[model samples]
Target: MLTGLNVAVIGGDARQLEVIRKLTELDAKLFLIGFDQLDHGFTGASKVKLDEVQFKEIDAIILPIPGTNHEGIIDTVFSNEEVKLTEDLVKSTPPHCVIYSGITNAYLDKIVQSTDRKLIQLFERDDVAIYNSIPTVEGTIMMVIQHTDITIHGSKIAVLGLGRVGMSVARTFSALGANVKVGARDTAHIARITEMGLTPFYLDAIQKEVEDIDVCINTIPHLIVTAQVISKMPAHTLIVDLASKPGGTDFRYAEKRGIKALLAPGLPGIVAPKTAGQIIANVLSQLLHDLVKERKGSSQ
Candidate 1:
């Protein structure tokens, strides 16, 4: 049990409720930063205002995935309160305090380094990424079926990137009898796509490969689908971008060209919050148990 630790869960969506519940069950005293809207009457946790004063005794800090904004403003989807995770706020934490988040950018990393604190990125773990891909792919399929008029069988499909999500998308699409073609920068990935009995094309030649793709799924986080690429696609093509915010496709251009393009970032939370929450909770429990073991070992 996390008997003496003070854990602060700052902000997140529905999945965060599971994290908070699990942490509370572990006997960790939780200080909720921004959850005024949720009055689920959780017994062990108390809501606290986000201010410089609250940093006095926090043993650990947990933030939502994508933690803070580029401007360092932290958004709590469960509440209306706004908290700025400023450099000053970070520097005030105790030396032993650890910051846990899903993904961190260079800006947040700089602040953590400057404060001489450790930051744990949970999303970097292979298990998390692989397990998370299940929901992501499922959500993508759900979106495709919901938006498209044509059946997936015998349709020409183009999937960009051969990463975890892309591979899953390709395999699932292929299983449903779609002629799946994957675009990738790596020769190894392209070869793997072919080995799986699917057509592979170089990402540079993606436009040339797909002239009448029924459904195009982009897993790459950057702007891979430009106007030139969209112009090459059939007007009825449905583009699903599963990347982070400001996804890979040119939304404005797709709209202007009358192509059905969708930017889906957090599908797990939207489609299956319970499953997503459990995935996060399972990982978090293991981490806390490991921390307990480490503490016990040092004491012995």
Candidate 2:
């Protein structure tokens, strides 16, 4: 139980609700920031302005999956209020306070470094990324079905990258009887794709691979699918770029070529918020428990 722990949850969508519920159930005193428009509240959580939170009492701070933008402006769906995460706010927190976010950018990293606060990025963990792949694959299937006239059973699909999410996406599509070809630069990943009974190709050969592919799903965050690569694909092909914002695919080129392209960043949150939330909450609960033990040990 996080009996005497004080946690501050700041700015998030439906996924944050599960984190709040789990923390509150563990008896953590929670100061909720950016939840003004929320219709309901948790028993142990209280909505408060950022300025009103007792930073000295906070043991942990939870940020939304998207975290803060480059300007430190938090993205919140629950409130109309604009909450900016400043270095001063973080510096005010106690020395033991740890900040948590799904992901972090250079700006967020800078703030944490300057404040000398510990920042944990949940998405960087293997367990989190692997589990997140499930919902992403489901969402990808949904997008393909909704946008395409062809069935997945006999479609020629190309999945770029063999990371945690990439591997899952490739496996699922192949299992559905699609002719899945995975693109990877790593020799080990290439061999693994072959071992999985899927075709494997070098990323540099992407142009040749997409020529006849019915669907091209890119997991690489880089610009692998450039205008030149998109030019080689069939006009009826569908492109699903699952990387972060401004995905790998050339959206403008795909549009000019009349090929349908979609940039889906947070598919898990969009398609299965409850499951995604539970994944995050479970991991966070474990982290908090460890924190409790560490605190006790340090004091002794």
Candidate 3:
């Protein structure tokens, strides 16, 4: 039990509710920041403003999945106030206090490093990424259905990248009878795609492959779908980019060419908050428990 542990849950979306519930159940004293507009309350949690939180007493600080942006601005869905995480705020925490986030940016990295604090990025774990692909694939299928008039049964689909989300997308679309082709940079990934009975092509040859595609899904975080690549595709092609913010697609070029392009990141959280939150909460609970045990052992 986290009876004496103090945790501060900062700005997030619907998924943060599940995290709060799980943490409260463990008996941790929670100071919920950026939840002023929330109507409900937890047994061991209290909604508080950022200034009210005593940073030195915090054992852990939980940040939203996207964490802070380049300007240190956090996404606060339940509050009207703008929450910014600065270096001074982190430095005020106890030396052993750990910071948890889904991902980190240059701004967050710099501050955390300056403070010499432990920062755990949960989404970097293989299990989290693989499990998250389930919801992402489901969301992708939903979007495909909503946007395209043609059926997925026989449509030509191109999935760029063979990572966790890309693999799932290819498999699911192929299973639905779509003519799925996956593009990859690594030879091993190309071989794996071929082994899965789906067509595989080198990413460099993407222009040739997308010429007749009905739908193009990009999982690469870089500028893989450039103007040249989009020009090669049919006008009816739908481009779905699942990469992080400022996705891989050339939106301006796509728009100029009259092509429909969508940037969808954090699909799991958007499509299935409860499941996504549980995934995070489960992992977080175990990690915190392990931390507590380690600290106890060292003290003994």
Q: Give the per-residue lDDT digits (tens) of candidate 3, residues 1-300.
A: 877889999999999999999989999899999999999899999999999999999989999999988999899999999999989999999888899999998999999899999999999998889989999999999999999999999999999999989999999999999999999999999999999999999998999999999999999999999999999999999999999989999999999999999999999999999999999998888888877887789779
In lDDT terms, how accurate is model 1?
Answer: 0.85
Candidates ranked by lDDT: 3, 2, 1
Residue-by-residue lDDT tens digits, candidate 1, 187-211? 9998999999999999989888769
Candidates sorted by TM-score, descending order?
2, 3, 1
Candidates' C-alpha lDDT = 0.85, 0.94, 0.94
Q: What is residue 28's positional error in candidate 3, in angstroms? A: 1.4
TM-score, predicted candidate 1 vs. hidden true structure:
0.93
Better of 1 and 3 by lDDT: 3
Each candidate's clash count: 0, 0, 0
Tens-place lDDT per residue, model 2, 38-115, is 999899999999889879889999999988999999988999999999999999888999999999999999999999
lDDT of 3: 0.94
